[model samples]
Target: MGCGPSQARVLSQAPISSNPDEFFPYQGSGPWHTSRADSVMQPRLAKSGPASSEDCPPVTLQELLKKAAEEKGDKLALKVERPCPSLGSDGGAPPAFPDEEWKAWTYREYYDESRQAARGFMKLGFEAFDTLAIWGFNTPEWLLSALAAGFAGGKVGGLYPTDTPETAAFKIVHSGASVVVIEDKAKLERLIPALAQRGEATTRIKAFVAYGFEPEAQQSVEVKGSAKPVLSWSQLMTMGKEAKDSVTESSADPLELRLKAVEPGHCAVLVYTSGTTGEPKAVMLSHDCMVFETRTVLNLARAHMGLCAQAEQERVLSYLPLSHVAGAMVDICFPFVATATTPAWVTIYCARPYDLKVGSLGDRLRIARPTIFLGVPLVWEKVADKLRAIGAANSGLKKKLGNWAKSKGLKNSKARLMGGDGAAPFAYGLANKVILSKVKAKLGLDCVKFGATGAAPIRVDTLQYFGSLGITINEVYGMSESCAACTVSTDQAHLWGSCGFQLPGVEVKAFKVDPADISKKEECPRAPSMDDLGEEYQGELCFRGRSIMMGYLGQPDLGADHVREIERKTAETIDTEGWLHSGDKGMITKHGMVKITGRYKELIIGAGGENIAPVPIEDHIKACCDGVNEVMMIGDKRKYNVALITLKAVGANGETPGTDQLDAGARRINPNVSKISEALRDDVWIQEVTAAVKSANENGKVCPNNAFKIQKFMILPTNFSEEQGFLTPTKKLKRPIVENAFKKQIDMMYSSSETYVRYED
Candidate 1:
């Protein structure tokens, strides 16, 4: 719990401001530095449409921070809460974090410390515009380093904590990072040797800063064979503080000069995408891109939920992977903008990744009481499943009361979906007070005004399940290239399955293309209505705006070949007219709502050469089959489609399997079998699963034609997991890898004449 010297602490009696102008008064023309030619490409916009609104003018990270310091100086900016080590027993038990006190940092202290860290970078021979690669989980140090790099006129990239040593080294070398910030000594120990092995590739890394060390601890750690030592976080700050008075050949320290010389259009963040095929691509997002998105989100939130800066501020939990753009946007960029632009200063609570698993999340949520929350589909599914289990255990009057309350909640939410306030029913009010409110409080979601789901496909049933519990999980659609969001579902404009309307300033369209011959394409007309869309209008979703990234990272300095390679890759994504093709099949309504269907690459073609989207079909099967974890459709070039299903099982992390022991839901599917290994052989389990598949195929809503139905199916012994390289870091399935991994089982399913084949082990 003792991290180091406290950077800042929350004051018991900080003055509150009601006026926005008094809270943040700075407004100035910003081309602070000249645009550098270092970028391989710059952000491009369409021929017509507003790139940004006049209300939210473009600003650099430096400008934004400076303004915050000037106006919201004493406001709390960040807080880290962890259980006291002294209070927990040393019996290998988890820490009790519920009532733990948080260490806080005000805007003034945060900005000042980041500047010191920036000066520290200059002391370590860090040059302008160099990339700073961070390999760690969410923490104050991780955020500080990112801001420090931006202050030093450089861009920063994050490496997933779960990334392998080779993958981490590759990203470090590929980005040409001058410095790397690792979470702790343990990760540093693992990464150093791998970097050392790279030899010339890693020579660009002039220094390594180790975070999570005590303030008075050793300044540097020496590795066995390496000549250079890794500097501790405290040591980096000390260097920055000392460098404040030390003038070089120049008139002032390089920190101030870099700040003055950095342009808003320059790349500020590097998000490495985990592509299914090859090496991860480093997405270059500019300062303007991030700022534009932050401002736009604020506007949307204010319009929908009346989100504003006031005496009562918004609290957010930063638990998602910092490597992902959505996490960074909400946890990092959003807070800064909220503090600077409005009177309600935001407070960010940092949580470790482990806190996201099952029961641990509730502990953090109960403490943070965040106003806004975002989760992937898997996270929501687990939450709903957990609640379902708890509800099933209810007895006597509790069971009857719970059932009655849930029905009321579902009716209320469904009413809202049809343009009603959902508050007209007297029973609805009583239900919320008696049951739904208590349920929300227990989950630490009582204060959550906005809940969202994104990153991967989510089931409609899961969304509806949350609605039954009085939580509306708004769906959002975008990629890392679009700075996290292109379309967002809000309270004002929401449809259960839709991704919602396009952002105010952005332009979006669905272009028509044949699944077999995608190269030949044309722009499809928008549907006359939001609900009714013809098949002809369903096409590849595309968008363009100022929020779009500058370009993918390139190695132009290497030569013409590298330059050409960069151009080729860029052209594949962003067309000449600046529309960034999303690679997703979707349709846009005349009302501007967007509904994403599936990925073009994941489209399955049958023996009759009929185009079929597998995701919706897979989703339907999972929804129909209780205790089913994952349903993958396979029939790319066959007579009919088949499925590979994974049952819920006991796991270290709830989703990823650690043992074959069946979970409660899975066991309930067949009480005769207690383990997945046994359940696979049970005739009852197989019969039930077969019936579910039959139900899904016959449901006209999902599968309109016989060609789209899943014909044959087999249950996989294991789940598709990231640890097994069958899933991406975001929990998205690597379709080709999954198909290749189960080739034998898939072939066996098709070879058999039976409708449902049981693989003989």
Candidate 2:
């Protein structure tokens, strides 16, 4: 209302207004700091078609929140992330799913808490355009503060709580945030070292707030020869109360004020994404873009979460990192919309497994009875491994009854792993009613209505395992730059390896070997531009639409490289087009679904003259391994295949059976591991994975109708991590680290032996 926001430019998802005064937290800063003013308000036709009056008015996220708040002020708007209290220091027992102690905030509570945090930021001398840093594990406080700052139209950046002072400082200074929120003394202490190295580090960060600490807790600190204010979370409420009391009784219209400050074009989120070449790049996302993308996904996931027609009795368990876009949108935005629309109907608990260590997630799931569960590929693989472990232990009993059941037409018997299990892709009736059902019940996942998996490929074997258990794993494809979920599977059209169709309006196309480069001696010989392939051909996947990020915060070159625009016909690259060249390689299926092969950079060249995609293969391998946590395939320009497999430790202390029991299981070849492995090795899951690998080969297609196969492979011991320089913040592998760690095993595995010792974690 105050500023000249171009109505024509606003994004469909941008908020209609953000009344600074009407809202409890208010904008920590003024409108100048918001992404709306820059990215959306000055829109250059972000929508697909030319502007027209007939189009239905856009459903603004901003309007949605305010309306919901009005309709259900007493209803829960959002919940803060809380960690499991039961988890031991050494990552002992996984929290039981239904553990209720982890509830961090109710919707109304989270909204109020964030408002208070916003008020606390104001008391700490924070102003508009000023940024705040949240460094911690996924917890309610971190999320509350972040949203408060966002609503207030300020820049908010989340740093991993586990980050060293150096990494944390780099982001703090880069974002120029004056407020930093944390979880404990350990994270608080990091600032000291960072400030010691550079006094300016503390300059941008005027306050450090720790969550789950008492107001009177003596968490004081000093750096650069001066003391700093350490505010316990409880004290923040007092600050917000004080600040609210002091603001003029008559203030700017909350809705108008919000509309004035919010625009669609500005940077809304500053997420840190680690690149192959260097330090993390801050990926800037606009409010309008993110708000819109989230709405699409939320609507898609809504039905599964039982929010569709049920509208009530819904809950969510927040466990992913807040720094990641997926977690932020869901924990902060999704509930707000759901509340605004349904109000008082849905019940949600946003807590992490780490915070509720008292019980296993199994029990927590039972308590929450969450309708929707989202996770990464590693999680699904782990589930499969756990199932196999229990089945192996029960195979003997199953065998005794196997023939008897066969006589009863129990073709798809859910019995323990048996050769018969491979013949029938269905879950054994008894197995589901007994073994797996018990697992879900124990994990509190029995009532889970939907599941989402992303960040990596999930082998069909893994997917089928969950399907058999009566749990549907919804696979999503996205990246930090794409706000985490670009595409996801619904139970209706779910496929094993495909990432699913383009999200509602998003467009995806493959850019493989350029037609111009097909000549005997092509000019430049550059990587295939978008112009290379036609429909259904494999190539680097390039996409466009509202989901694209604004750019890297401080890295121009990298941002330019990622956001290339081009005309649809020529495949000519244009920096101005806003099309994102996703580094992921893929092919458009004739049916129009996208089949993501692997990362463009991670594609391995097989000695058999095939381009192999390791992700899918790795996905299956992890599925078959009892304790596999992560698997990295490495065989570029090498014969056959070899992998660096990090087995998931069975228990907190990496418990293994006694030698006698272990020998028994090992000697019997574990009917369970063998059956699962056989399914992976020949059940078409590994076949599909290896085929993807071969297709990625420079050799291109494997002569129509022929899918590539893994001639041979070796699975080795050891998992990679950031601490070990094996993974980036996004969880993608650092190939160099993995290759170096497994060079010897890889060499031997590819040798005539075609086998190696697989270690037990």
Candidate 3:
């Protein structure tokens, strides 16, 4: 998703409005509304300098650092993006939303804190060869741990906060970390029993540092260990403060201690990627590689989607786990990179801030009137739910009428459904003005220039709803193995259903398709490759660039299995030599853009001779019905498809859709979630989705048994979760785990139609 075309202005300071654009500082410098018909994308951010490539010598990240050091020694590096951390219960939940007045650190302050944390770890006996394990949700402290560890010349292992106790302890022991940073005492308590079971491994942790602690924490951390606990977040920064104090009027830079400690090519981060078999393997990324990849992200065409500092307003609401590459890149690397050297040039207003939380995390996103926002698909889905709920709360008829009008391309209009239009849907802007707009006002996301949806494909309808609200949906595409920078749909050429062009500095080409399997890759269903016709070409996507990772850590066997030099062929084509084999299968479009279809390993092999990719079914089915939150098609080796569905709750969005004479204005099950859920379970649409998934797979070879498409499925009361071991950290369900966990429910689905059935939008 990218920004759609820019539209004309309609200004109003008040949050409530007929025109959605008015909430934007339309009266301010930027235009408010954008044209619906415009090409999809947010307004492009103003150039940071001349084009980043404008410099003749060309500015690599290393070169930019060199320039920043020489010209702006005393300037900021990284700082707290908020005024101060909100210390509260449930891991700082209530105050996670946006605030206009808050403390944000300057680059100098951030650098100082990181250096101090590095020194503090050092003081506690951590050294270059030692490892410090950090397990926590995303927060300033999480960022500090990674940065400080890197600066101190030590490698860090980021264990997910929600990891099973066994898994947590295993990763800790595996990384050989001598120190551990805990977010709070509750997590520490959970770790103690598991650690105790590991004997020598858990005892090796010499010190524990707690982040986001409440006053009731002291008694909870008493485990049977000699290791001391520390709760000096405020006191720990004295080193930086003291260093600042020691500086004289004519003193050299006070952050010299922090600067000289960093070294590239050292072990920077250890991120774990689960394998097709056995346990998860650690991917070791070098400092040089990590920094360069982050820079590649900075160079992406979609960077303009963020809130610009120039808007006199800017903010980032962060909730992604800092342990993962995406979180670390955004919170620790991207923010530092963006704000560092050009502090004077960027004037981002501080508003939205994310506080640490377990289970679910959300915040008010205060953005520059024209700003960039990046989030995974789940975030947008939630936003859509909120909008529908709000709009439906008012007169259902009026809301329907309003939505219908808005659908007809009217921005804001008044419609009274005192009688007629009762059967129609709400006006288009109806949801925008009445429902989503209020949510945006509360979250302060009304001014967002554009936002990115990635880590998974987002339903186009979700993007469309946000578009109606005046926020552009910018789609992003990438994989963790590729340093998380890959094909992001740029403002131009952002075609629906395809990831945009290959990014600059990266060259993508399809080399070969197993001619025996050429029919599988054919566009017209098993047609031959030709000129005005086709030339069958497709396979595992191969990528070569600085952004590629340094390979799996300590797992040379795995590295040998996949990593290779770039491929270079007979026709000066590719160096067809050795290219890193990305596990995904894809085809090159006529425009030279790479279109990935599915994972080679995850393809379902059916007993009745149907090949399927569950994702496409999940995507299409979930889209066909508003009731289903997530759909996972199981039955990989079985005779047919079976699904495990998580319902989108009734009254979760827009007054449960319809209200009949039964006084069902806001009833939960009438047009209830279950009823709606059953409607989507309609056999016709199910068959259609099954066929679509099949078509996307082996290129449209329908199996003989239509009834076997999806004989039966269990509707789940709750969605899968990482902590529950039903899903991976990235939100992809763990197939085996999910099947085992829901075995009883699955049995019921097949043995009987116990799950309710009905139909409603």
Candidate with maximal TM-score: 1
Clashes of each: 2, 76, 61
Model 1 clash tally, residue pairs: 2
**Full-model lDDT for every candidate:** 0.75, 0.53, 0.49
Poorest stretch of ten by lDDT in candidate 2: 1-10
Cα error, candidate 2, residue 658 (Å): 17
What lDDT tens digits, residue by residue, belong to model 2 across residues 1-761? 01110111111121112222211121232121112213442222222321111111244444555566566666544343244445567656654433434443455565566666677777776666467788877666666787677555576788865566888877777666777777767666666787677554455567777775553465556755666688887787688778766767587533235335755555667787665546666667766656667666755555333343343545666666678776767665666666665422444565553432222444445556665667665455545565555555665767545333332223332221111122333435565565555656756576665577876566766666665555656678877666767666655445555676566545555665353431111112222322233333666666555566665554222234332321121122212234456767777554445677667678777666666666655554444443345556666776445555443332211111111112112223333443322323333333433443344332333222222344444433333555555665555567876677667766665664533333222
Instruction: Write model 1 residue lDDT over 1-761, tens digit each, in one string.
Output: 10111111111211122233321111242111112225533333322223423455667887888788889889788888643232225322255455346888888988999999988987887788888899988888888888998899898889988788888987888787888888766777778777776666566677788886542344444333444547888888999999986866757766878988787778888898977778888888888888877887777676566565334567788888888998879888888788888766778888755565434767777778888888888788878878887888789999999999988888877766624553535588789888998998888788776788889989988888888888888788899988999888766656788887777566677987545543446888877665564678788998766787777777533456765676567667766456678899889776667888778889998788877888888888788776888889999988889999888876625334546887746767877788878877788888888888998899786687888899899887877777788877788889999899889999999898887777665
- Candidate 3 lDDT over residue span 43-120, tens digit each: 111122211223112222322334444444454333233434554664444444233344444445454566677666
Candidate 1 Cα misplacement greater than 4 A, ranges: 1-37, 40-53, 82-95, 98-100, 196-199, 213-226, 247-250, 418-423, 513-521, 528-533, 556-560, 652-655, 759-761
Cα displacement (Å) at residue 136, model 2 = 1.2
**Winner on TM-score (2 vs 3):** 2
> What ordering of candidates by TM-score runs from best to worst?
1, 2, 3
